[model samples]
Target chain A: MQAFDIEVTLGRTRVLHGVDFTAKPGQVTAIVGPNGSGKTTLLRATTGEIPFTGRVLLNGEDVARQKPWQLAAIRGVQPQSTTIAFPFTVVEIVRLGLTAGLSAANTDLPVRALEKVDLTGFENRMYQDLSGGEQQRVQLARVLTQIWQPMVDGTPRWLILDEPVASLDIGHQFTVMDLTRDFATRGGGVVAVMHDLNLTAMFADRVVLMQDGRIAAQGTPSEVLTDATLTQTYGCPIPVNTTPPVGMPFLLPQARMTREPC
Target chain B: MSLAVDAPSVHAPPMDRRVQARRLTVALSLLLAVTSVFSLAWGASGTSLWAAMADLAAGRELSRLDRIVLFDIRLPRLCLGILVGASLAASGAVMQGLFRNPLADPGLIGVSAGAGLAAITAIVLGAMLPPAIRELTGNYLVPISAFFGGWGSTLVLYRVATRHGQTSVATMLLAGIALGALAGALSGILVYMADDSQLRDLTFWGMGSLAGATWAKVMAATPIILAALAVTPFLARGLNGLALGEAAAGHIGISVQLIKNTSILAVAAATGAAVAVSGGIGFIGIVVPHLLRLATGPDHHSLLPNAALLGATLLLAADMIARVIIAPAELPIGIVTAVLGAPVFLWILLKRRGALGL
Candidate 1:
């Protein structure tokens, strides 16, 4: 998927200013930034949920020219949070994805997707009664059910997620991230807006760091996750460290004790 | 991998209600059959459906009174009741699904009032029309005007309550009240201008009765109501997707705009035709869908058809009570439904107060 010259103006204040973004098949692309940096707006614009100035091309076709069902056959999207209108069971919610995408014939995909999210036994439970994290996972399962196969025919499918693990516990966080990674490994592209830099570094094949609605840096995690760049982008003293054997980058932000207590 | 190993091995099957819903459909069909028989057999007239059937079984021709009462009067009333009841209930389910609120209903949301106003206008001022158009529309002028009025109100209500594809329940309900009041005020003006004979027609029409049912009225409403009903099966999957909200629903391959537009038109058509024929029957739209949701689940695939059958049955029962309660003098069918349905509606409100965030 490719988006170029994307400009989003929300009530006279331009949020994204001529930003260019691209995500290749068979990889996980993570967009990370501080709050109010327009990461979510960029994602929404690219997904055709909002109007923007420039062009978004998915699978070599302009998104504006494609029908929604045509796009859905090749991709699935998971929002930050979903509020269901009615009292739907977990299985029912998951099953919604089956008819929405290319998996209409696969009746068991909902159960399998739930299993992938480690929510195997939650099929019968009321979706509204679940905890926040469980609801998030159930949503993930639903999205997964939409494009159950990583590749259809010779083309790869895509998963566009907004904070896929925002409400999860640490263990389920790993579970979801691993699922995305597995999807990427199987030739499906995954684009996610991530808040945790460490998880992004660990899971993302390419990282795009945003600052004030512009792409501050974009490259491999090691190239873009330097202490200087991290500190400059976030306006904090973030120290970058590396794992001993694997040479993976990590960050630990230190609080400056400059303010006196009241 | 370890998470998989740590998880429980006992795998319960997914709790799907499709089977039970299908059974409920069968059950509701049977209930409608029983109700229709009772509605046809028991009435103010002495002619009995059982006697008529027995006579047919004995290879005897029916008497003139039996033919007139059974075929002409009772049959048309039964058919209108089924058509109007199905239209109201199916319109309710569609509205609730479209607005993503269980409380959304044509009667509650002023579509009925708008239709009623237009119908009232047709009644009070129909004579002023040019003879050409008047002759052209004849019996169809009121229903067609009412359909357009209903369509206009629903479109306006949708615009006011939804923003960025999210519908606010509070805003929708409040806007419905405002729209209903506006239509009622206009209807009052039209009623004041009505002649004495027109005033009597308006009064009984406002109260809602099956007493006006005729072959002509039933035929006039049939095409519109059936056309509306025919569009709903195509809408089932879209409405199911819409339970997840418009944005998510779009992501899941539904043309959200198409669903919204079709739902609005369907609601307007069904409600308009029913209101044009029967005036203002209240609560079936809200009560039927809510009860079905509680019984089977909120899946519109079954909810809609079952709602039609159940609505038909319930309305017929209500019509029977309206016929028999005062002996020779009949009450309005709307009164019976409101008396039976209002408490159930209130109970639903009280039970779902927290969920509805009211």
Candidate 2:
């Protein structure tokens, strides 16, 4: 998946400004930024969920020229949150994914997806009755059902998720991240807007860090997650540390008063 | 890795009501068949369906009275009942799906009132049209006018209630009340301008009945109603996707714009034709779909077809009660449906008060 010179304007405010993005198959790409830094906007524009000025190419086909069904066959999107209008069972919600895309012939995908999201026994339960984290996982299961096969016809499919783990508990968060990693390992492209930098460092093959609607940095976790870059982009004094064995980068922000005693 | 290793057993079948819903479809079809027989058999006329069948069994020709009553009077009424009933209920389900609110109905939201107003205008002022146009429209003038009216009102209501792809249920209901009252006031003026003969026509029409059912009315409504219902099965998948809201629906490969436009047109066509033929019937639209949702799930694939059957059966049963409750004089069918359906609607409202955020 690739986007070139993408720009998005919401009302009078320009949220994204001439941003270029790309994600290769067999990789997990995470876009991480502070609130209002346009990570979600860039993702939405790439998915064609909102109008934007640019070109988005998915699997070498211009997304603007492709029909929605054609696009759906190549990619599945999971929104930040979903509000269902009627009472639907968990299985029914997951099964809705089966009507679209290349996965339509895969009748077993919904059950398999539920198991992946750790909601295997929730098929009979009402979606409205689920907890916030549970609902988020159910939505992931549905999206997973849509793109059950990571690659179709030797072409890589994509999972474009907006904050897929924002509402999840720690354990379920790892569960979802692992699923995305598995898809990437199986030759599908995974692009996600992430909030937790630690999780991004752990799971993302590449990280694009943004500030003020522009890509401040883009590289592997170690190259882009230094203390100076983190402090400059987030406007806080964030101290970066590396695990001794693997040299994996992590950060913990300390309170100003605690660092300098009154 | 450990969590993945200890995953839940994958042998359990995924739970769904497809089998039960299919079975319910068959059950509802049988119910509609029985209701149609009873509706044809029991009426103010003395001719009996059993006697006619018995005569046929004995190889004797039926009398003129039986033939006229059964074939002429009762058959047309039954056909109109089925067409109008199915139209109203299916329209209701589609509208609710489009608006993402179960409370959205043609009758409740002024689409029916708008159609009724246009129909009254046609009845009162149709003679004033130029000779060329009058001859051109003939029997179709009222229904066509009603269709445009219904289409216009639904479009305007949709615009008012939805903003930025979100529909406000409160705004929709309030706007519906305002639109209904506006149509009602205009209809009252048209009613006042009608002549003595036209006034009698208007009164009974406003109350709503199958008494005016004729082969002409049935033929006129059949094509439009059937055409509208035909568009619904195509709409079922789109409507199901829309339950997750417009943006999410679009993400799932549904052409959301096409679905919304088609749903509006179908609702207008069905509601307009039904209202044109039968005047203003209340509650059937809202009541039938809501009841069906409770019995089965809200999956439109089953909900819409079952709604049509249940709507037809319920309307016929209500018409039967209207025929016998007052006996010979006959009350209006609308009154019977409203009386039977209003309490159930209220009960639903009470049950889902929290969900509705009322």
Candidate maximizing lDDT:
1
Q: Which portions of model 1 miss their true places by more than 4 Å? A: A242-262, B1-10
True contacts kept of 2: 0.67
lDDT of 1 by residue, B98-198 (tens): 99999998988899999999899998999999999999998898898889889999999999999998888899999999999999999999999999999
DockQ of each: 0.64, 0.49
Off by over 4 Å in 2: A242-262, B1-15
Interface RMSD of 1: 1.3
What number of clashing residue pairs does each candidate have, in the order they appear? 0, 0
lDDT (10s digit) by residue, model 1, range A177-261: 8899889999999999999888898889999999898999998888889999999999998877744446666333222222221
The lowest-lDDT stretch of 10 consecutive residues in candidate 2 chain A is: A253-262
* Model 2 C-alpha lDDT per residue in residues B204-274, reported as the tens digit of each score: 66778888899999988998999999999999999999998888888789999999999999999999999
Where does model 2 sit among the CAPRI classes?
medium
Question: How much is B195 displaced in model 1, in angstroms?
Answer: 0.9
